[model samples]
Every structure is written in C-alpha cells, then in structure tokens.
Target chain A: AKSVSISVEGMTCSSCVQSIEQHLGKMNGIHNIKVSLEDKNAVVIYDSKLQTPVTLQEAICDMGFDATLAD
Target chain B: LQKHEFFVDMTCEGCSNAVTRVLHRLGGVNFDIDLPNKKVYIDSEHNVDTLLETLKKTGKNASYLGEKSAQ
Candidate 1:
C-alpha cells in the first residue's frame, strides 16, 4: 500500500471530518484515512493499483469538499 | 428521468448540505455532487431553470451545465 496526503478547504467541526472520512472510506482500495479538521488535510493509505490521487480527490469531491494533492 | 447538471462553488460539507437541502425542497429530485469539479447532477422531472434558481438561493454561485432526459 502507498500513502498520500491531500490539502482540503472549508472543513469545519468534527462532523465535517467524519463526513469526509466516512464517504472516502466507502471507496474500494482505501485502506486507511486520517482527516484533520484543524489542519484542513487528509492522509490516506491505499492500494496503489486500485486508486490514484485523482480518484482520491474525486471521492473528497463526492462528499462536497474541495480537495487537492498536498504539495 | 431527466439528468441535470450544474457547476456550484462549494468549499465544505456545510455548503454541500445546503445544496442537498435545497434540492430536497425541490421535490422529486435526487442529486450527486462533485465538489472538486464544482458540479451537481440531479435526476428529476423538474426543468433546468428551477434547479438553477434553487441552487442560487443557497447563496453559492451556480451555473447550469445542460440536461439530458432518459427515454
């Protein structure tokens, strides 16, 4: 498994954190996820063959938050 | 069913929830939001203009992205 970190914008409260984590977790290939509302970022560990940064970003978008690969 | 698409500028879960709330109020509509792409897809019997107006009422700048109706 490979790990990737992403920067997110406009997350407020624990509910936001939970929502993002829960939605992304439902996607296949996502093995682990850590979202920090304070830092406005998420670290995800997943199967490299099954997911990509773009797909991860899409999952975040699906939950209604802006996300991009962390620089 | 008709498929309508819109581009909405949303930054967080709260914004998405707002969108969902408005869509639900529209009645006979179900939606899928694509946050990174800033888009929302709706399956409904309503026309595009009503959906566009409803999204704007959420205080987020939104635009119609066309519509497709399934036979």
Candidate 2:
C-alpha cells in the first residue's frame, strides 16, 4: 500500500468531510483514509498498482472539493 | 470569529456523526461538515479553544488549522 497526504480546500463542515470520505471509500484498492479538518488535508492509504495519486485527486475534485497532493 | 481547521482521526459515518453532535452542542452553526475530509467549518460566537476541547473529549485529536478573519 502506498501512503499519500493531500491538502483539500473549501471544506467547511463535518458533513463535507463525510462526503469526501464516502466517495473515496467507494473506490477500489483504497485501504484507509484519515482526514484533518484543522489541517485542511487528508492522508490516504491505497494500492499503487490499483490506483494512482492523480486518480485520487480526480476523485476528490469530483466531489466538489479542491484537492492537491501534499508536498 | 475565526475559521480553524482541525486534523482528526475518524474512520466511519458513526465517527462523523459523533463529531457533529458534539460540535452542535457547542452552539455554532456548522457552515460545512465533510466527513470524508475530516473537516468542519463553523461560524460561532464562541471561543475556538472550547470547541477544540470538546472534540478531544470525544476521543478525537483536533488542532487549530488557522482562522479566516471576519470582514
């Protein structure tokens, strides 16, 4: 599993967080996800062979949240 | 009031609900609550420190991500 952290912007509440989590969880090969409202970021654990970081960013964008890979 | 982001460890829908209930009790209007991102945006007339403490009481880690100055 590859671990990557991402910074997300425009999230305003817990429900938004839930939405992001639910959507990402639906994707295959995602092993785990941890989000921080304070940091405006999320750390995801997934299989590199099954999914790439770019795919994950697209998933977040599809949910109406701006997400970028954390440096 | 200031806008703050918190980094938390939440695993499921239940966890998101738990955080929401606790935050609501503190008397702030949750402008945005996204569970997938583990983020909550609130417009409160109260101190943020108290709110952060409330989240901690529920077994979640929280911090002040920052605040947006009210215009």
Residue range A1-71, candidate 1, lDDT tens digits = 99999988767767667767776787799999999988889999999899998899866754556678866
Candidate 2: segments with Cα more than 4 A from true spot: B1-71
Best by TM-score: 1
lDDT of 1: 0.78
Find the 10 residues in a row with the least total lDDT in model 2 chain B: B55-64
TM score of chain A per candidate: 0.93, 0.94
Q: Candidate 2's residue-wise lDDT over A1-71, tens digit each?
A: 99999898766667667666776877899999887778998889999998999998867754445689866
- Given the true complex, what DockQ would model 2 score? 0.03
Reference-based TM-score, model 2: 0.50
**Model 1 chain B worst lDDT window (10 residues):** B52-61
